[model samples]
Target: MDTRPRRRRWPIVAAGVAAFTASAAIFSQIAFAATLFSDNFEDGDLGGWSKSGGTWAVVSDGSKALNQSNSGSENAREFAGDTGWTNYTVSARVKPTSLPGNGLAGLLARAKSSTTFYRLALVPGGVQLQAVNSGSVTVLGQVSRTVSTGTWYTLSLTVSGSTISGAVDGASVGSGSSSVASSGRIGVQTAYAAASFDDVTVSDTAGPAPTTTGPTPTKSPTPTKSPTPTPTSGGGGSTPTGSWPSSTGSVSVSGTIKVSGSLDGGMKRYCCIGDGSQSESQDPMFELADGATLKNVIIGSPAGDGVHCLGRCTIQNVWWEDVGEDAATFLGTSGGDSYVIGGGARSASDKVFQHNGNGTVHISGFYASDIGKLYRGCGNCTNHYERHVTVDNVLLNKAKYVVGINTNWGDTATLTRVVVQSSSGIHVCAEYTGVAKGSEPKYLGDGMGDGHCNFTSSDITYK
Candidate 1:
């Protein structure tokens, strides 16, 4: 059952043609230090900042307003240039008026798109850190540091490695961390609320920031199955070699091989082998090659699990559609890092598509529907020793059960800048020593629940 709704890409408009190329150059001049990246909202030229097409309106205050009222947008600031900063800090001063339905204002870091990135916003109610992986956006942390509506408030956001910390009015409000493999562009954002931004800046907080070298593009590996010879038997002649037959194929794998096809037709038997235990055994159509970095691949199937992994793999810009069960299932028998980056899975059942063995699982920019369990660790399964699983910029549209993180057997998992719109059951659950406890997860905007999870012990801001 395809649970994914047809998504409409929001059109963005660049306000003024004032390209602040000097902003990046200024930052680089200061040893790539922090530098302002705005049009100063002084001149009518809003630099390159844009709005979500006409979703928001821009107005100027005729009177002497903060940062020259004639400059800032009326409602919200939209996406802009791709300021490539791997590890840096972004801060802005915003004066928010009446709280919009989705009131928000802040700096957007590692922004691949308007819907996928890390956002640090300050509302009339509080401050929040959110990430949008795929279509799902998760609120990693939030604090009740209320800001007076229509008043100017300085918001500072810092991102180093996988951790993002935020402060309001120079006071540390909320902070959290997650695993982000790649660096993305930056921008500012506002919902359906009027806000004014001033002194927007981006700079390296730690040592020298990495240069904005374009992303290294990788090719999708050609999928190959195990070369098991077919035998002529009573079932149905000889089973096809390399390809699994839906009627009478047996499942067996000797090693691992790159996968590139779908088993739309039901398969009775399937197996694939690679070099020295890099093996993958699955009964589904798609199989991710071990240690293969995949980019821009689509997995389409009919009411079945997408890919079941028996080894480690790295996937990026991948999409799974119409999966009966989970999209991608991982059984870490070999014990290595398995990653899923920038993709969504639409499933009929619980979207518990990706499971982890003892290996680490890092998911960024992922969206799913009815996610039963994002990452499930087997009982006492530590072949690779699962350390940390980070999910960044993940959004769950409709989850009847647990939405965020659900680990059965004790495995450390981190949900950063994540958002869940509507959920019918708990948000997060973890089972350690046969005892599961954590915040009672609920629908969107609900505060954190009390439980026996590490999140409760930490200083996590919830709205």
Candidate 2:
């Protein structure tokens, strides 16, 4: 039963452009460091800070710290000291007493107003950096790091020129860039969470001026453009004798290859591996060798997996359309790191990601839609092992999974800032032990799907 929907290419392409080029404008500016404002919250009141939207107060015992007690839809913030500073650093000691329904607490720097700012959030599953401009939100980076409630942690966020960076405790989490709102106020922020803060400080940094760099023109082999995949024909035209696999094709690779053009499958299906079905070819258009790095390529509709990557590989800035099975498959000899960044795979009757072996996979700025399963760990939980998968800042639409968690095998699945719409969502298997934030129907109940598996503790949110 193939339950995936047929999706168009334009929307996916547009999203790919936005996803990959998000930091293009901001990354050009260089940054330096300086001190701005520091608040220890020694007073027992919210005196110099401006409150917006949620209930906020300052608590005092032997020490003083700011607190917010709202667990509702409205977010809470307290702006203090500066509103004209840009390219600054904000740091604080914070503790979250309660996190309700994907709640978050963190620092808000370069805030334009109550609704607009650069946010670096610390949640139950991980850390996220986002840019909110004129009420529109854009997630810049998401790093998976499990944080517990009622624990004090130091969070520091720096915006130097166009670069935005964050750190927790002492180690760096992740960094992202945006030039949307250049200058604004510094504040503390929380969403759907009740938290307390102390020793808040803000610093203005000296940064380099922004500059634009143009591309250098050079002659190269022109890549092929394959036709979109359709139900009737396998893909578009047939593969020419000298292209791709053939030595004469525009794509020639010994180890790593970056294709600037699209690939045509020639409507041919190579029958080998697929999702439960063997009649359909499971072979990818290009079977990547181990240690290969493939980037900047558009994979046309293939009969099987679009690119079968073995061992450690890096796939970046690639768009996939009209695939028969998973868009990309990561198989490890033992285990390794497979990275999928800044691209999307759509319109598959099978899963978007097929993990058949044990490995660590990082997928970020990735868009997946219209697939039977968003992620397929082990087929049978007791049979094979599961891989460590971290999905960050991903947008999933019209996708469903039969067993969302470790169906039969390996380990943790950490999902952050994932937006799900009109989808069956994921099944929470007993073996899965991670969190899914900003996504609904995150777990399976007693009588749902293949029946529920019992577990001691689960942070999964079910509706």
Clash number for each model: 46, 14
Instruction: Give lDDT tens digits, candidate 1, residues 179-273.
Output: 54246566666654556665566655554323322222132211122211211222211111112112333444343324643122232333332
* Candidate 2 lDDT by residue in tens digits, 85-172: 7766788888888876578898888776455578778877876677764334666666676778888889877777787777777666
Candidate 1 residue-wise lDDT at 174? 50
Error of 1 at 5 (Å): 44
Instruction: Report the Cα lDDT for candidate 1.
Output: 0.49
The Cα RMSD in angstroms, rounded to one decimal, for candidate 2 relative to the true structure is 18.7
Which candidate's lDDT is highest? 2
Model 1 spans with C-alpha error above 4 angstroms:
1-36, 50-58, 62-77, 100-102, 208-463
Instruction: Assess each prediction's global lDDT (C-alpha) against the native.
Output: 0.49, 0.57
